[model samples]
Target chain A: MRATLMPVRIADDLYEFSVKDPPEARALAKALGDHPLALEVVAGLDRVAVQFAAKDETEVSRWLNQVAAPEVTHEDAADPIEIHVKYGGDTGPDFEAVCAALSLTRAELIELHTSLVHRVEMIGFTPGFAYISGLPDDIEIPRLDQPRTRVPAGSIGLSAAYTGIYALAGPGGWPLIGRTDAKLFDAARDPAFLLTPGATLRFHER
Target chain B: MLHILTPGLQTSLQGTPRTGYRAFGIPYAGPADEVSMALANRLVGNAPTATCLEITYGGFEAELEATCTLAITGAVGEILLNGTPVHAHQTLHGRAGDKLTLSPPQFGARAYLAIASGFQAQSHFGSTSTYLPAQLGGHEGRALRTGDRLTALSTGQATATLSTPEDLIPVFSDAFALRTCESAETHLLAPRSRDQLFNTNFVAGRQATRMGIELTGPPLEISGDGLMKSAPVFPGTIQCPQSGIPIALSCDAQTTGGYPRIASIARCDRHQLGQIRPGNSVLLLRRTPDEAVREGLEKQTLLKKWLGSALP
Candidate 1:
């Protein structure tokens, strides 16, 4: 059975749709990714908000029906791309504290972080900052009480069930587990962001 | 090159926000007062989306490198041509050494100065608007400074004059009434919070900048708690954080936020937001969804009819 669609009013031009979970949300994103009225699509943990150029209830309902279709599958079609990460060193300042809080050793934390392939849940917070799912629930942590004045670019940060890489250097509170040499965001690049929503990726210790 | 004699508090080249990129966490970062920017471009016979200088709170001056014609719109301030006062709402000419100076904004919070050929500022992602947070676009991706020299993308007619209809100009005042409409979480707010949001008065906070306008007033009460799953937010989204102060997002707002979106300034009345100065009292008046769209369409028709040759 399919999950129930929960539509939330975000703003005059925005309507947010939440389904069962991250995977079900991805299915909804796949079904309605190309609607002309969907000027912008922002995928969240369990929801996807579409900013319509013009608010049309009928179009929204039709789009929701398409998302609710039984044939939709959650997996992204692209082959997983692997990212190189240097974990628990100068690159990650909060790594030891995070490991201790989760009662994990350094090696255990790295193994847990890289054990499974992750999917892009959303790209928000900052330009090119991708929220990736698949961090071990056993070691899931909260964002720092006080955000650092600056979190260097390519730093891997974890909060709750998701982990993300800082695309641009700015203020962020996500607990750093590692850093990557990979360029997360490059304006000169054809695809500016390393991971767009629905792209599957895997992180490995460098 | 147009010599920057003095840069205003915040001066930057403006183009429309980068659309379709919001999903990537990029805010549109366009001109805050699009209507005024359009009028300035129209008067100079430039494309509506052509690059122009958006001067915040005036205090800007520039030297004409070559004889040039330009148009100014938005703020009502002292316009000096070679130290001589020149009137606004009409095009003005300057010789190579002629200096144009604009005093502090007397009526509006921002002003537009569109040169004949539009600015040839550096661009990223096909937009010239400066987004300060990311240090992207404009001259080295920051606000204009005194030593900064700008070049026009192209040269146009040396001399021309045009005036916008007086009826179209939005009057800037200490009191602003923004027609607002409900958002998704508006229903989640406490009944008293809803009443306070619409009926209460708020003074624009000192934290007001291009990104958003912070309002100081009674904190809006809400029973719901916890950060929202980050979602797409527009320029007009009114986010009331736990602090109770409401921040009305503007052209430079972030792509998504976790704050409760209690209301949104209607699309039609958003231009007025650019003219609202900090400390200005704003009233969040209620508006129907139908009325919001109708007014926006009406304004679009008005712009098309008046600037037929200039509009896209």
Candidate 2:
């Protein structure tokens, strides 16, 4: 843990705490997230931002002063959410391109993809778009040279070290390998997002 | 009900920002110009958070189907009631069948229209503001189209005529010097590039929208490889990409970004960002965080004094 965590005021209603460690930053976000004044708590790669209705740094500062760095371990994870995917067809438009680029057969690619457990690193881009991390270094893929103006919702995309779901149909550049039926985001749902930061999951071929 | 005779470019409903959901990749989508929205609402005797129409580049026309009072604000040029010229920033009474038309703005890019009781809209995440990309909030989660009808939330009863004081009206111009403060990655910019950012005026590129405005100027050089972990970005955040041009995030911008954040427009000056038109000249004026806070509070105090409890 760092010697001290200081919150930097970025805007009138926004304050950012720069913590280099991702897990600690997420832990810090979890600690201060429930503050009454905190409208939103977002944990990013190396920082966490707390948003409030107005400028209230004194209360946030007091809350931060009292927070002890909490340990984050896999043992603390809840039951993994299972997502079944339909791989390699029209739903997976870039499957052939990925197979050609990685020099793997269709069956081999699916085996590599389904074997490992993925962790939700962060959520961004669009509502409920979870950036699932833990892609093996060897299988890391590049984003498309030209982004599609609209990638259908529930489309599963892989790029660099993360796998993402197109929770809502919009523009995207990721290479899609499969599609899922699960609704990642529905404003009508009680908890809109299916996956949140730090959640773990595994994919299975349908 | 208001009958849409002609929908201007990207006219849609906006209300108080959709807060408390940024972590889900949702943005605080609301009126781009919060000050203008408040002024318009006040003239119509509605609360500051009441829903209003956000018209981009003006060119709007509508017919009132019920007796109501209306107020227009923001970057506006010519306004006509029943084809006779009318003024902006003041309350105007309209009877059934009266026509209201707004010409393209003379300077800025957006205008706001508010009714006495506010417009009825589909609310999402506790806001009526439209988030176009997500197809959420506002009317049918889309921009207004010709022939579409908008209903008032309740029957409007006109209050005493009110006009915004001359001193309180905001000026829209082609050139703006926005007050800004350093962000998470400000130090990463090279010394020469950092100086150039604050000293030079940038021309707004063609890609201007509620999401962000692309700016073109001398390429700002970064000292390092410029790769950083993806991080949270808010409205008014200035991000520098590999191409060196900066993009200023606005109200409808995504919750997170991967580009290097060089600076952020001070809260006091961010409302003006909504008025920025394509090809407008913009300069980032640096200030300390303490100075930014003071300026923001002072502006809020002024608005509160004028609008009373209506200023949120």
Candidate 3:
């Protein structure tokens, strides 16, 4: 555990706290995440970026040291939310290329991918785009060398072990293994983003 | 409300940034040049957070439906009211049915047009700023297009004229310098790469946008292992990808990134950042974090003194 508190003042209103430990950092993240004064809790790998309003830094700093960090369950050990996907067609143009790169048949690929559940590490890039952790080692791959100018929304993409869905299609480089019809973000929905950090996710072939 | 005759470059409605929701991957969309936007809003008796049109590289035309007090700020563009020359940095009285056009394309990028009492818009996640990627807020969640009409909160009764204080006016230049503090991972860079960041007069590339600005010069070669674990990144962070090209994250940048950040531009210079055009060359002047913060506070105090109070 990081005994002392050392926060890097990134900007006039932005401060980043490094806890070194992921869970403890997440604990601090969750503890003050939606706190009225903190404003936004932007969590990084092992740090929580507290962006406060101008002139509120002193008060926010005081709120930081005394706050209790609640225990947050790891996504890997949490209950899984099933995601239905369509592999290897218009929805997933890079499916064959991915399988060929990994030396796995379509069935083998599907079996390996669906077997171990993934965890939502963080939400980033675009609105509602969650970075999923824990892909099977055998199926791990890098992002495409040439990014597609326009990727379809709902595209399931992978770069290294991290898999995520492009909630709203735009420019993307992650190799698409498949696509899901599941809505990750919708303005009309009560909570716009369907996936939150530390949530478990499972893939089911449709 | 004003009717858009032509959207010109990329005109969108932006106000104060949508802060606090970055954890959900929401980009903090707002006016690129915040200081200029605030000044424009204040000139017309509206709060700086009021909704305003963000015009890019000039080429915009609009006709007013009602008379309103308006001020245009940021970038240098020729403003014409019904084919007559009008100047920026001063409040202009717009009569109903009058036409306002920003033309001739300024050397700088982005301009803010704020009307008195502000334009009314729905706030999504606590901001009216337009972020098109998610189609979230602002006028239909996208750039203001041709034939689109926007109504002011209240208008047709002109307010008293106000001109910017002579010393408070911004100076536009094609070349400038930004003071920056080296990042935590600065030691990871090759000594030459570190030197290039501060010494090189890097030119802003054509790929500049509200999301980020690409600076092209000598490729800032790095000898690090490879890609890094994704980490939190701020608007003024200057990150270098595998390509060695440095990218300055702006208002609409993602909350986090995987590339190695070389230096963070001082918060004081970000308002200047919005005015830097594609061809503009900039030097990343080095500064300590404490120095950066102190300079910013000083500037803020000066601005408040000139504006007669705290900035909106």
Candidate 4:
């Protein structure tokens, strides 16, 4: 069945598509990413905005009318990238506090975090900062009362429903549980960002 | 080479915006007011997208190490060349060792300084414009400070002296009536509150930054859940936080936001958001999407008359 794309005009050249859930939004975003006229596509949690290269309403309308909604595949075809993490030490100052808040021991916290495969819902806030979805509900917690002045790059942080990676050092409020040596972002690299929307990843405890 | 005697308030190099990277959480960091920047560049014979100096709230002073053709445009009070007053929005000739200074602005908040061949800076993610938060692009990826030295990209002589026509020069007023269109969550607002958003004159709060501007006025209550899933937001997006204060996102705003997007300033009126200062009055006039697009096209046609393809 073709998914309906009822795009609402956001600006002269920008249009937004609101979907029922993240999976649908991701599928729509992936389809729009390949559209010839799309200059850019930003996928939020439940909506996707496509910025056109130019204001060509006729072409846009025709395509929208004719195009079929591509298949919605929650599981990515490629293997999940593994991120090695060092949990619960100086690298993760909030580790003890987070464990206590969630009523779990260090090993249990690490196991719960690494057990599930998380999909990158979006990359935002800062360059290469990936918002990963699929965090277990039982261990979800609020962010720090006061944000840290600087979060080390490669820091693994968790919020209520999402886990994120700190691409570069700056102010952050997410409760950190571990640190990784893998580079999250390098502007000089061809693919400046280590993660992109819809990519699946799994955390591995060292 | 140009020597910064006093860097004023947050002076930096700006040029064409970095595009095609917003999907990776990058912002389009370009000149706040593209019209003024283009005018300044026209006076010095530089391309509209050439790198130039963006000075905020005036009080900038600089010393020249070489003779060059230059132009200053935007809000201003007094322009002094070796203590002799000069005018803005016109081409100027400077000699080696000459000192140029600008006083506080009389109305607007930013000024554009363009040299004959433009300034040279390191490009990051595609443009020379600076993104301060990520420490990317421009000179050292930071604001210009005292004692900084910058070199001109090229030393060619500028085109014949020219002045912006009086009628073409934009006037910065304390009050602005910006055209806007309803956004994703506009209907979520109470019917009375929706009317209030259009009828009331909101005052710009002091918490203004390059990323966004805060407006204070009568609280516009939202009948439904004000918070929604994070969604893509742009420079002109007006997000209403739970505090009831609406914030108009600017060029450096985040790629996405969680606040309810109440309205979006029309593209034609978005440039003015760069000049709005604390305490300024703003009225968000409602317009349909079709009307907003037509206005933007009309404005672009007007801008193309003198600025060529330059559209703010």
lDDT of 1 by residue, A91-167 (tens): 99889988888888999888887888888878877788888887766555766644465788899988777788888
lDDT score for residue A52 of model 1: 66
Candidate with top lDDT is 2
Q: All predictions: root-mean-square deviation over Cα?
A: 3.9, 3.2, 2.9, 3.6
Query: TM-score (0 to 1) for chain A, all models?
Result: 0.79, 0.76, 0.76, 0.74
* Residue ranges of candidate 2 with Cα displaced over 4 Å: A1-4, A11-13, A20-23, A52-66, A71-110, A137-156, A171-182, A204-206, B310-312
> Interface-residue RMSD per candidate?
2.9, 2.8, 2.5, 3.1
Candidate 4 chain A: worst-modelled 10 consecutive residues by lDDT: A138-147
Reference-based lDDT, residue B303, model 4: 70
Write the residue-wise lDDT of candidate 3 on A56-171 in tens digits. 65687787665544566653566798999898888888889888988889999888778877888788777888788768644557665434657888999877677878898776
Give me the chain B TM-score of candidate 1.
0.95
Predicted model with the maximum DockQ: 3
lDDT of 4: 0.82
Interface RMSD of 2: 2.8
**How well does candidate 1 match the true structure in TM-score terms?**
0.84
lDDT of 1 by residue, B1-312 (tens): 589989979999888677767767887887888888888888878777778899998899888888777888888689898889987767777678888899987666999988888887778877888887777788888899998888887664655578878876666778888889988667667888888888978999876777778878988765655345555667888877656677898887776665667788887777777888888899988976667766666777888776663222
Docking class of 4: acceptable
- 10 residues in a row with least lDDT, candidate 3 chain A: A138-147
Off by over 4 Å in 4: A1-4, A20-27, A34-36, A53-62, A73-111, A137-160, A166-183, A202-206, B310-312
**DockQ for all candidate structures vs. native:** 0.43, 0.49, 0.53, 0.44
- How do the predictions measure up, each by TM-score? 0.84, 0.89, 0.91, 0.87
What's the CA error at residue A125 for candidate 4, in Å? 3.0
| Tens digit per residue, CA lDDT, model 4, A143-172 | 664446579988988876788888877656
